[model samples]
Target: MRILGLDVGDKRIGIAISDPMGWTAQGIETLKRQSKEKDLARLVELIHTYEVDTIVCGLPRNMNGTYGPKAEETRRFGDKLQEHFQIPLIYWDERLTTVSAQKTLLQGDVSRAKRKEVVDKIAAVFILQNYLDARAKS
Candidate 1:
């Protein structure tokens, strides 16, 4: 079964997809948020296009491990997505995922402008990959 991963942000939503066998995660595309209706519609289209069975949403938490307003917003988004798509949704702790992505891009000598373009999507890939790896080991 294929799983979709989302890094939800205020202006953009990064997307990632797991392999059919659920072994690995790959960065897909970034969804530019226009409106809730449009964003959800686009997400539904992606779900259908990729034949996604499950969705993994990144939940931002404070360093002290508390859910903040952003996490609450993410939960609401996930709820809406589940209601619309009728797909299973899981929340993954996304602490420092963006930081990790940034560091990775820096190591690869990616320019700041380019990193801004792909950081969220790369973070989504990291989130999904971590989930896939954990599932494989279990």
Candidate 2:
């Protein structure tokens, strides 16, 4: 079974998917958030399309390992997603995932504008890859 990953933000939601063997993750797309209903609808569609058995959502945490407002919102989102999707949802610590994505993009000399457009999806990939790697090692 495949797994899906999400990097939820205020204006956009980044999507990623694991290979059937759960070996790797690749960026799918970035969804522009419209409303809660629309977001959930799109997510359901993606879950069905990918035949996802599990969902891993990025949970932003402060450097000191504390939950902030954004983290709280992420938890709420996960709760809503679990209620609607009725699938196992896991939250992975996503501290600095975005920063890592940005650094990778900069090192690759990606255009600033293009980086902005794809950063969320790349971050999602990193988040998912981390989860997959951890699972593999365990």
Candidate 3:
């Protein structure tokens, strides 16, 4: 089954898609958020295009394993998405996915501007891959 992963933020939402077998995740695009209506519209288009059966969203929990404001915002957004699409939604703890993505880009010698452009999508990949890995192990 194809799965869509999202790293949601106030300004932009990172997008990723899993392979049909759910063995790998690929970065898609960084969606610039305009409004709730617009964002959901764009997501609906993606979900349809990719034939996504499940959604894995990154929850920005604190390092101490506590939910913070950002996590709450992500949950709210996920709730809206679920209400709109009626799709199964799963939240993956994403504490340092962005930092990990940034370091990976730096290691690859990507320029700052390029990193800025792709970091979100990369983070989404990390989130999705982690979830896939954990599920596989279990």
TM agreement with the true structure for every prediction: 0.97, 0.97, 0.98
Error of 3 at 55 (Å): 0.4
Cα-based lDDT at residue 68, candidate 3:
85
Task: Rank the models by lDDT, top first.
Answer: 3, 2, 1
What are the clashing pairs of model 3?
none
Off by over 4 Å in 1: none
Which lDDT tens digits does candidate 3 get at residues 47-109? 999999999999998788999888889999999999999999999998899999999999999
Query: How would the candidate models be sorted by TM-score, starting from the highest?
Result: 3, 2, 1
Q: Could you tell me the lDDT of residue 45 within candidate 3?
A: 95
User: lDDT tens digits, residues 3-56, model 1?
Assistant: 999999998998999989999999998887899999988888888898999999
> Which ranges of candidate 3 are over 4 A from the true structure?
none
For model 1, what is the alpha-carbon lDDT of residue 58?
A: 93
lDDT (C-alpha, whole model) for all candidates: 0.92, 0.95, 0.95
Per-residue lDDT of 74 in model 3: 93
Q: Identify the runs in model 2 with alpha carbons over 4 angstroms from their true place.
A: none
Candidate 2: 10-residue stretch with minimal lDDT: 113-122
Residues 22-75 of candidate 2: C-alpha lDDT, one tens digit per residue = 999999998989999999999999999999999999999999999999999999
